[model samples]
Target: MQPGLKLSQKVFFLVAVPLTVQLTFVAMLGHLLDQAEKEREREGRARQIIHHVNQIHRIIIGYIAGVAGEGLIGGGSKLEQSYSLRAGFDRELPPLQALLADNPKEFAHLLRLQKKAEASAEKLKQVKRMFKHGGDLALAGELPTMKLILRDLISELEAILSEERLIERTSPKIQATQRQRVRELLLTGVILNIIISIVLVFYFNKSFTNRLAIMMDNSIRLGLGQRLNPPLSGNDELSHLDSRFRDMTGALDAAARKERAVVENAADVIFSLDDSANFTKVSPAALKMWGYDPAFLVGKHCLAIVPKVDAKKTMEALNKVKSDDANNTFESRVVRKHGEIIDIVWSVHWSEPDNLFFCVAHDITERKIAEQVIKEAEARVRQILESLPIGLMMVTLDGKIVLANKTFEEVFGFNLADIEGETIDSILVDNRS
Candidate 1:
């Protein structure tokens, strides 16, 4: 899971879980509210039925005591009391019927109560009729039966009241149970949320920190110039970075190898000198050119190998190369390890990054010897030309007098230096010739 999920996905999951839990909790709270509303409605209906039953009982008592006059015993006449009682009965009957309809087992008990109420209502009507006929004794005689009917009705009402009271008494326990369920659900949600949070934290921390630690160790190894293992693999950003780092290191290694090959196999004596003109590095060819190991030359000043007679000139050239930031070529005599003075032609350039001068020196001893031999032969030829008795001159194809011997110059009464580059026609007797 950790490998499959990205950092952002992990964070989103963490956030979404809590929101889902909250939504579920809200749903549960809504259900609890609905249950509470139903409990309140049940309690209200039971109280209303009890109130109606109580009103009916009061009217019955008033009728039996012959105090059913307006504001006499219960605040209305007997006929008015009957109407009020009927209204009360009418209000109470539907709920009772509904209760019996819902619970048919209670129908047997309610059937007896309903018969007694009907009998009481009939007796009430009779007593009212007797009063209208002025039969006071007959009305009085029917009072006991009416009283018995009222008693039976009251008893049935008391039974219903007892059932309502029992229901009322049990309501708190039911509410308590519901409340306990809500608390349990809440506690379960909290515990589950906490457990999920803990698991996410542990997984994320372990996974992220472990991978990051591996990357950190790899970076440290790279810094120390140590070999690295295969890069971490995944589609995550860190994995991509690690792969890119691997590519960069591979490129750098190839470049270093190529540079090392060039430095090692170069024919010229390649070396670098610091700003103070001291050698920092010397290639292997120095051993062949200077008869000194390359390692022995490092840290030595450039003038250390130059002959005393050429040291001043070499220093001047070095200064020029450094100040002008340009390539310089100069030939100078250097003393080898075996105490021999050899000629070498050097090419030097200043490097800004290392604050050093990169130099390539080529051994020019044989070339210098050949040049000296050519110079001696030329001097001998000049001596022979000067020793000639007759006048002689050399002219180029372009009609210029290129050379004239001392005797020729003396004979012609003209100096060779003055007529060397002059057109042969210029010195001729006839200018056109």
Candidate 2:
């Protein structure tokens, strides 16, 4: 995975894994909130049922006690108690019916309680009818049965209340269990996320550090001019960078080899001198030019081979090359290994990076000897031409008087320097007839 993935992709995966885990936990928390809302609604319904049953029980007790007003029996005007009791049952029945619709089996006991309440209400109505038609004695006779029915209704209503109370008591424990389960799930998810994050961080850090270390080692080797091995294999960015670095190093090495080839096979004596004018490198051509092995000349001063007469001039030229940052050409005589003197023309320049002077020396001894011979021949011809009885002058094919003897200068009233560049036609005697 490390080898195949890019750095950005790996970072995204690491970040997304933890975020995804947290999002899952957030979803679970939302579910927990929904469950809590449901629990609240169920609790409200249970409380409503308990309140309705309590009201029913109070109305039965008051009816038996012959009280009136609210749930009381005989406190209100004559028909008000009966009317109030009936109105109370009428108002409470709808909620009970709604509860029955939601959980028919759970509120089955309330159905029996409602039947008893209705029967007691009918019995009370019968006693009122007997009192109106059959007088006080008939009312007194129905009172015992009315009491018995009231007792049964009260018992049924109490039973419903007890059931509701039990449910209310157990609901909190159930909700607590659900909350604990959710908390455990959240804790487990958080722990798992942390563990995964740690593992991934360690894995990636180790992988990146190791690969970077290899690249750094390779860079150090390159700086020291040492050979390098192939870089580690991968398709990632670091791998590509390493590949480019290797190519650059290979190109530099090839260029160095080509330059060495040029210097080794050159005809002139190619060499480099240190800042102190000591020979640091000498090419193989030194053997043919200086009659000394290149190996023997390394570390020697540049003035070591220079004749005493030419040493000052060579040093001055070397200083000018360094100070001016330019190439310089000069001729000097050098003493060879077998004590033979050779004239050589040297071209030298300062190399700032190497803190050295690079020089290419060409042996010019044969050319110098040829030039000296020509100078002597010209002097002898001038002497001979001057000593002759007849004046003589030398001219070029282009009609330029290049040389005129002292006798010709006297005859023409002009020195050789005056007529040197004058055309021959301008200086010749007019002999045409």
Candidate 3:
């Protein structure tokens, strides 16, 4: 809407766009880092498996050589050789198989290797049982079978070890390539954001900021009573605004001239009073009517102008206006500058924006005197009606008494003030049901 405000919004979008991109990149990088770490852990486990299998193969070879060498020596115990083979197999196989279960690509191969090892260990256990039997017949049947199975186990373990080595060699390079691809995607997104930001900044400066600045300048010139010299060549909102401001300025000038004429020449004493009941302005007519200069009455309390006898009534009228009623008008008497009391017809209404009572009043001394004469004549008629010789009552076309004399008031036990304007049904005919 405004030039400076548009610039601020552009700056905010610029900052916020880049910050969001950076956050997204950071989240992606964290995910890639997590994947890399998982691959490294798998590689480490593969290496450990290879190392343990190799150790198991070396122990098997040593056991076979020891059994053959000790048979030639005629001194080694069969129990000692059997215990060495079984203890080494138990220490290595089960837990390694459990760890390998997580790697689906390698699990089938590892499981095959595990079954071969278990078969060899089972043959070694049978050979140990024959040795415990302690006869040449028991040894002859189991030792040859155990040696062949152990050799097969050694070959399977070497094959699995070679596969683990291949995985270890390739994993790091794959991780590095994945990281590079992620960085490239992130870089492309950042470049797109920068280009869009440049376009947005251009639009903000050219379309919004410049146009809004021109509007404000035109408005300020109009406010200072200067002609609008807008460069209007296009069917744009700014052109429409410039045209509207020109129209408004012309209307204001005409209204000011009209008000000046009225203030200078009006017959009524038009004035305004602040909320505290003090006068702020008075028309020229006020000076002529009161025989006091208008300046002498300005800035005086409105109550001070009224006679003491009517001061409370004037106050009541002012209070009624502040209570949110419609336009209020009251007639009151005021002592003029010449020390003579005058009757004025006064009207006052509240204006919220100025926090004041706008009032207009004019002298009505002749009309007030005429109305007093009329009231006296009506009172004389009432006196004549009260002193009637017969039961005379005046009723409207409807069967209701409108005017009642003294005899009527006595008959009804109600005064004229009580039932004078009331409907016939409201006042009982004879105080009966």
Candidate 4:
């Protein structure tokens, strides 16, 4: 295995290993089958040779019997039968020779046997001509000599049969040896294939799972704010995945830092509450707004800092932001640690996964106080204006009335509410219509 091997290549190697072994096994099995076929063919050829040898041997023995059986049969029938036996011997000879032709030694022996048969033929012709012309008594001198020649030929053929039968006898043992070889080859092939597969699987599994474990450990370290492991030394998919994970972690860390800086430098109070509505985090502005240590506010219930009069409204605001991405904007009075109450306009957002409510509180106490003073001044002006106004009304640049005195209202039969947003053009058009 190369150090820089890719994942797909490793996977291919894992599959290819066993496949290669199986292919090799199949190739070897094919060779064995070929050998078995050849052996079977050789055995069949031997059996054919044995059959032809037996037929020839039987005809040669009959030849000897017919020649010596003159007293036991009529002369004419005996001569006819002798000729027929001679023809049978001639017919069987060529086929036996052909069968033995594959073996040089056997073919040479058969050639010699054919030559000896030819020599006996001349001797038989001479005796047959004597017996035919002069009858049974004429063959008395030649019978013993002719029988000797035929007997010698029979002796040689029997020797050949003995050798052939010996060969035939060993066929079963040879077949058994072939069978054993086949069984051994099949068993060896199976065992080798299994071993190859198991070894490769274990090796690939070890390497792959080890790398996966390292990647998993890196993820845990990242989550716990610990340093990550060094990048893996490969171009495999797992290594690529680990690199991407590191990149994502770097991006997330940058984003978190930016958010932290924003929260720290912000002038308004920023805080978070846990699922139990307990204060879990408070920004640095807590000291300026709440007049308390941010650490001191941790684990404190939100209602502790909320005035009783505004507690219900604050609870309602919290409920409004219950689901993820939901937000609520409202104003509530918060009690400072110094026991003073102040108005705060809150913008709250919910994050269900974190089970926290993120809130920004802007103190609106000064704005509310200024609003009260403006309303009081407007009331005093209205009193003075009502005392001396004679159909006097205040209008905006668009000729829409903004304010009207009682005198103006009585004369026009219109209050400021009726004409406050109406353009001069629309009002005149309405009056004409």
Candidate 5:
């Protein structure tokens, strides 16, 4: 959310924050599962302790009943069965104690149960000693007392069983609590993750999407030669790109203005022609050079203004420029609006990308007249030199004969045509050599 954050930073924030939250959620779920596992283990141990205590109570009851029934039938108590059952109690005690060790209250009950069993075992030993004398009546007299002692032992075990059953009953409550906590944790984690994703997406959409759209619009506006939007805020890359784009737009605008100014004020006609040699653009100088408005001539074939005599030459120049992709300069004549024909020296360059010819036409009518005048003066000077010639010859400083009068050529028996541009030494060869 901070300003000037780079795109990568924003992405990291979006990704890393959710990952951290998810990891925390996973850790919480793991802790909940561990607690649930411990509860289940405790419940299982409680069930085992309850089962063991009930088995001990059943064994003591059977032992007392068997002894009483045998004495009623005039048979002495079986010492083997008495000792065997006592041995069974001994084996069951250790396991019950181990099962209840984790629960202090249950274990204390187990301790009381253990003391009762030891007392019951000692009384059974004394009863068995009476049985060794083989008197059925004496066995009958001791039966009720033994039954009473064994009943007390069974009562102590019942207390232990009741405590274990109570623990087992509470298991469902603990499991229900665990299930509720699981649902809450799952719902909370899911809601939190969804909210975070939505918030990050919303922020990025609000922050980036609009700016990107503006940038796209700016591109279209710049191409249309329209003003651009203001520079974007912040120092991020997108903003920096926008700043650079604006600067480029400024440069292009300046260049376009300068080109327009030059075209408007130039003395020579600067114009462009398409592939078909139609005038695509004509500068204001078309008026000064050919007495026609640029707007009137634009979109018209260039041959319309070119004199019929020079149209072939103009087409040749255009074709040469197009085929060679090079610049060409030629002298051509164009008819003005006032029925006057003027000499124009056109310098044309071909643009391959635009498939157009960019041309500059300079009026060369004065230069042509001046060249004609210089030719006439040279003829007059030669006529005067021929009339007064006394066998005269004119030579350059390099000793190459430039001219010879008619009289001089006749006397030397040499034709001026033969000796012209030749060194004088060719005619003056020495016989001594």
Candidate 6:
């Protein structure tokens, strides 16, 4: 119930709980985004690795196939052009070695594929040597058997390249699984955020607004001269206010007794009215001001005391005060008990809960004369400002003009109406300024 305790509860639920949930959600979302990005990059690398491996494999197969086809169909011109064949194999080996170094489990399979191509290269070298040393016709006789061996070796290499393609194809499914995990993490974060937000709103409402409502209700009861119990909730600021309200009720009782004793002894009349503009009570001061006795005013409507010419306006003003948040004060002609007219300033307070309000008044003929003098002075000042010859301008500290008189329009070529809300820089042709 202490003020500190109330603040601590607000901080715990509205600040601490929400901040913890937000940090946890942000951490989860950031981790998911990082993981998704990593998977995409890795998948791209995997495809690149496979593409390079396939390119080397293609060149190796094509070189060997070209040599075999040439020996079968023509002379060895195609085989000679493929010095590139040896260079391509040499270039591809180190990368393949590095790939296998990274993936030691894949080494044996890669090495098996490498060895198949190596065997075919050795066979082609032998066939090439035969053409160089043995006569062409004798080499031609040996070509049929060598050509068959070359065809079978090429088939084996193709089978190994096919296995590499299969491995590359699994990348998309791996990426998909990673994406689903990220989505789940994001959903969990959002759910946690919503739960924390609800708790924070509830804590704030209980800590501040609900407690203030309780305090205001107790104060209103005291205002109407009624007894109020101690607050049922926290002994914070609102509870202190409730204790003060109880003290005020006691004070009102003592004051009411003193006031009634004075009224009963007076030779004058004093009165109070309800919102329906009827008298609820009368004091001795009324007799001094209006020649009215307490007995004559009791249970009488207030319009009975007002001159008939001003009665409608006084009633309309009272109704306006009942509906508005502001209090109303006005002067009206009042009729004495014997019908003599007098002027008075009326003060009224409306209480919607109690269903009727109170009104009191005092003679205000001198104050009205003074107010009329002030009004005439204000009219003269307004006329002087309107008659000024020079253009008048009012600008804010930021150099934006808020008001400009008539002569300013001729100088600037714009009416105040056209440019009142616009910034100074907007009027320039080169707006960068």
Which model scores highest in lDDT? 5
RMSD of each: 5.5, 4.7, 14.4, 5.6, 3.6, 28.1
Residue 153 miss distance in model 3 (angstroms)? 1.1
Over the stretch 1-433, how does candidate 2's per-residue lDDT look in tens digits? 4676887787787788778888988898888878877886777778888888777676676665542121223233444465457677788778877865777654676778767777777776666666556555665676677668877887777677776787789889878877887888888887888898888778677657678888898999999998776686777788888899999999999998999999999998999999899999899998887888999999999899999999999999899999999998988888988899999998999989879998999999999999999999989987888898777887888889887777777877888877789897776688896
Give one digit per residue, the lDDT tens place, for model 1 in 1-433: 4566676786787788778988988798779867967776677666765665566567556555553243233334654756565566677677767754654544555677667667766767776665665455655666676667777877777876776777677777777777888888889888988887888777766667777888888878878889886667667767777788888888988998898788778877889999999999998888888888989999999889888899999989999998899998999888999899999998999988879999999888899999999999999998998899989999999889888988888888989889989998787795585
Candidate 6 deviant stretches above 4 angstroms = 1-4, 8-12, 66-74, 90-127, 130-167, 177-195, 229-232, 235-433
TM-score-best of 1 and 6: 1
Stretch of 10 with least lDDT, candidate 1? 67-76
Estimate candidate 1's RMSD in Å.
5.5
- Alpha carbon lDDT of each predicted model: 0.77, 0.79, 0.74, 0.79, 0.84, 0.68
Q: How far is candidate 5 from the true structure (C-alpha RMSD, Å)?
A: 3.6
Q: Candidate 5's residue-wise lDDT over 1-433, tens digit each?
A: 7659887787788789889999999999989988888889878988888788877877777676666555555343563476356676787888987777777876777787677777777787677666656567678779788968976877777777787688799987997899789889999999999998899888887667778888999999988878788888877778989998988888998999999999899999999999999999999999888999999999999999988888998899899989999888988999999989988898999999998999999999999899989999999988888887588888998899889888887788888999999998888868896
TM value for model 5? 0.84
TM-score for candidate 3: 0.43
User: Model 4 over residues 1-433: C-alpha lDDT tens digits?
Assistant: 5547888899888878778878987898788778777767777777877777677666666665555455335455465475555587678777787777777777776777667877876776676667666666776767788778877777666666666776677766777787788899899988887888778767776668877888899989988999988887677788788889989999989998999899988989999999778999999999998898899999999999999988998897788778536788999998998899999999998897798988899999999999999999999999988877598777688687677788987887877777776765654444565
Between candidates 2 and 5, the one scoring higher on TM-score is 5
| Cα error, candidate 5, residue 151 (Å) | 5.5
lDDT of 4 at 253: 95
Model 3, stretches more than 4 Å misplaced? 1-23, 71-83, 104-114, 122-148, 182-193, 220-433
TM-score of each: 0.69, 0.76, 0.43, 0.76, 0.84, 0.48
What are the clash counts of all predictions, listed in order? 0, 7, 0, 0, 0, 10
Model 1: lDDT to the true structure: 0.77
- Candidate 3: worst-modelled 10 consecutive residues by lDDT: 1-10
